[model samples]
Target: MIEFVLNGRPQKLDQVDPNLSILEWLRTKMRLTGTKEGCASGDCGACTVIIGTPDQSGKFQHEAVNSCISLIGSLHGKQLITIEAFRQEPGHPVQQTMMEQHGAQCGFCTPGIVMSLVALHASGQPDASSERAILEALSGNLCRCTGYRPIVAAGREALVQAWSPDDETHPAACLVQEKRALEATLSTGVGLSLPDGPRYDAPQTLDELRKLRGRFPEARLIAGGTDLALEITQQLKTLEHMISVERIPELSGCRVEGDELVIGAATTYRRFHRPISDRWPAFDGMLSRLGSLQIRNRGTVGGNIGNASPIGDMPPPLIALGATLVLDGPDGERRLPLEAFFLGYRKTDLQPGEFIHSVRVPMAQPGQRLFIYKVSKRLDDDISAVLGAFQLTLDGNEVVACRLAFGGMAATPARALAAETALCGQPWTEASVARAIAALASDFQPLSDVRASAGYRLQVAGNLLRRALLASDPRHNDEPMLVTDYA
Candidate 1:
């Protein structure tokens, strides 16, 4: 049985299929159809909902998640706030403000827009820069009818009247309760055993998961359903056995140990945003632009690396930062460097029954300059044509060390060893930059695709390296410039 609090009401179910998505459960089963389904694979945000979870500061944090791709089995004992549950008595402050700001047009996308605003408001962060954050939060949501001007204005208005932290519920309390329930259920060996074979089962411990993997060697292991949901919804493929690893507490925390940042396998990208953003301001821009708020809320960093998509946004940074992957199977645990984790396009080094347990990235030393650039047809919510990460260390006038990593340049995200070799000991100058650009051709034979032609990709990849070099030189690119809106 799966039980949860849906919009201030406690609900329980007995005969629910584990493969059922939260969107399907709400729309088809419960008849709460306010959350629309647009671009059902999670790119579009028509199915946005506010999910309340605990933050690092031990406070209730609300964030937007795409319900369309979120499996119902994943919501065991959690609180789910849909469009129908924003407020009971009257319209919420965000909704009222949107109406006041004339934000709705055609009104098809209003529900998602409001849910995203509610999440932003719940964060208790109010600033003029929040306008951009709000826009970024809704980037996955397409509003063809409205120009997005009014919606942005509505977000600003909501910020002015944002709720106090005291008004929010205690998510930690809910977590404790859910944890107890989960423990009791696990003690009873309760699982989603269905008639057509077990498609999904969320074990509570690593031992149980390992045993299940041993019994069914071909079972699919899922952490975040961001990628697997496509197989179920688009491909219409049915797996005989599916196991979710999110419920395992051992695989869901981020901690710093000595000189390494150890991130658990199931840690969501949104959870790492604040700490990472504080440490690396350059990464703040890239991380914020990774995906819409909904996708970020549910997607995990481990899932991103495990999927082994060449166009994934996080791999280039992980590779540049010298991250390592920790994998565990029936034979114990072994660790591998991030560079060796990917074998080819959509392929990895994991053996059968072995899964990635965590990722560890070493702390950056001083005097190391880091830069990442993403070139896509659209600025937000689009796959990259070329994603680049550059890290360099200089001693006096000579390059001491360098790491150049890129995505969309080959079948997998990889470091350009040849280019790095050319740049490492050379003088940090225009001539050295030209030599590094020349080495790129020998390093990668990029292919032509709808996203970009081979020629355009090669040009952009070289220019990105030059731009990174320029951006790293504080004496050249650090000066403040004035900006004005012309009449």
Candidate 2:
């Protein structure tokens, strides 16, 4: 049975459809209609919900996530907080500010906005009133009526206002109790077996996961269910047997061993954010643009690489950094370069009953340079049109080595062999960079899609390389490439 806490109440779920999404369970089964479903595919935030899970520091953490695409089976051993938990009629902090600031015109998107703001406050983070923090917190939410001005104002007001009140059941007090209640439930291990055909199994250890994979080779393995759950919700496909390795202690770890960073497969992007910023600061900007804070909270880096999406954010960086993958199966384990993991679009080198265990990335030497750039129409919560990752080592005025990789340019995120060859022994000059940019065309013939045309993608790839060159050149350190580039 799937046991969880629902708004300070203990709830046990069984005899429910394993394919049922959290949205369906909330709106239909529970008759709690506060959570609305705007875009069932997770684009609109009308169905946003807050889930309480332990953060990287092993403390209870609250995050806002899309409930439309999240499955009921995935809610095991966690706390589900919804809009119904708050009595807005009594002037809850978020609801009061939202109402006073005229944040809700249509009221359809209000619930999500309230929960999103609550999550930001619940994080115990400083400077939640900043414009950047408010924008990031509400990036996934769409309020067409208010035009986001009032909503943003309300978010700031919530942060600026003193939450103290005479009532014990006020929003602040309730939030404090919520965290304590959720932490109390964390000791409960996850294992849900439905009575019907479909079943959900969550293994706590790596050995148990390998055995489960061997026994149920046909079971669909899930890490975060960010993209995979769409198969059930959007495609209407039934996942009869499901196994998740999310809580496996071994797969969720990140450590450094002998000048190399070893990241477990189930490591979430949010957990890896600080480490990457401390170790490889170049990726910090691109990482922030990977997805919204909600998506990053639940989405895993290994999940991104495992899906083999051409536009995935992790592969290009791994390819450029010369990373390797470790896949373990019933027979044994094997290691290979990240480039070789993908054979084609949506195809991988994973054998039957085998899964990626961890990834090894070679740390940057003192003089090595790293660059990653992503291009999209919107800044946040949008897929990439083109993304590039490059690592270069120069010896005085000459290039000692170069490794380049790109996404959204081909069937798989792979290396640019011709581009790398062009810069291998060339001088670190504009002419050498131009030659290398020209070599990129021979490396990829990208397909045109809604995001960009084939010509635009190819040209953008070259322009990105040019930007990297200008940024890396020592002579251009004091100059700004763009007009708004102020430091």
Candidate 3:
């Protein structure tokens, strides 16, 4: 049976459709209509909900996630909170501010917005009141009828208010006890079999996961389910047998091992933010723009790499950083460069029984300059039209070594060996940058898509390289090169 806490109450289910999403279960089974579904594909955040999971300190850490694309099976040992949890009588801060600031009109998207703000408040982050922080928190929720002005105002007001989590009556406080109980049950491991011939298994250790993989070779491996869930929600495909790697201790966190950052395959982007930003400061802005806060909270780096999409945002930067992947299977473990994992469009080198174990990124060295630029249609929660990641190691003015990787410029996220060779021994100047720009034409011949034309993709790719060169040069230190730095 699958167990979880819903609205401060413990819930257990012995039979359920493994393909059912949290949104679907809420509205269909529980008849909780407060969580509305807009775009079932997770683009629109009308189905946003808060999920509370225990952190290392045994305190509940709340995060907002897109419910429509989140499978019900994934809520095994966590707290699933919906908009119905808040009451109108004892009004919550988010609801009160929404009414005081006139944040709702037609009220179709108010619940999701309120849930997002609630998550922001529950985080207790020091910068929750800042306009940028509030905007980042609400980036996933879209208000079509009422503009964002009043909603942003409500967010600003609600965040500044004092919230006491210690209150015995508060949901957060109540969930603490319930979460502990739920975790205790989860310690035995979870294996659910539905009447409809679908099974979901969550293994706690690497040995259990390896055995499960061997036993069910055709079973799909899931971690975070940000991309995998789309098979059910968007394409209407049901996953019969699934093995979850998220619960495995060996595949759920990151650590610094010597000169490399060793990140587990199931590590979510939210967990990866600090370590990646600490190592490469330039990645902060680009990583935030990769997806909405909701997506980042649930999306895993390994899933992004394994998906093998030509325009996947993380691959270009990871490739440029010279990252390596560790894969495990019946034959034991093997290591290979990240770039070599992608075989073709939507294809990877993973064998039938092999799975990505972890990724190792080398630490940045002195005199190494790195630039990551993502050109997308929208500033937030959008796919890239062209993402350019450049890393250069310079000996004085001349470039000793460099790596230029671009996504959305080819069939796979690949390096521009031709362009890198052009700047290997050249001076790090406008002249050398121009030469590399010219060589990029020979490196890639992109296709025309709805996001951008092939010519525009090529043009932007070169311009991004030039922007990196200008931003890296000491002569242009005072100039604003990044979009966030402009204002």
lDDT of 2: 0.82
The number of the candidate with the highest TM-score is 3
Q: What is the C-alpha lDDT of each candidate?
A: 0.76, 0.82, 0.86
Cα error, candidate 2, residue 121 (Å): 0.7
Per-residue error for 279 in candidate 2, Å, reads: 1.3
Global lDDT of model 3: 0.86
What TM-score against the true fold does each predicted structure earn?
0.90, 0.93, 0.96
Best by lDDT: 3
lDDT of candidate 1?
A: 0.76
lDDT per residue as tens, model 3, 317-387: 88998999999988899999999999999989998778889999989999887788888767788888888
Q: Given candidate 3, what's the lDDT at residue 212?
A: 85
Q: Candidate 1: deviation at residue 236, Å?
A: 2.0
Model 3 steric clash pairs: none
Task: Tell me the TM-score of model 1.
Answer: 0.90
Query: Which is the better candidate, 1 or 2, if ranked by lDDT?
Result: 2
TM-score (C-alpha, index-matched) for candidate 2 = 0.93
Per-residue lDDT, model 1, residue 249, is 70
Tens-digit lDDT track of model 1 for 1-487 = 6665677566776655776778888999889999998878988788888765533344445678888888877766466888786545456767877788888988888898888877776666645337677877778788878648888988877677634334445321221223333333334223465666656777878888788877777788777788888887788776567788887777887888888888888888877877665665567777776777678778888889989999898899789888889998888999988989899989999888887788987777877767888887776677788888887888876889988999999999999888999998999988998999999998899999888888887878898888876766777673111111111
All models, RMSD in angstroms = 4.2, 3.4, 2.3
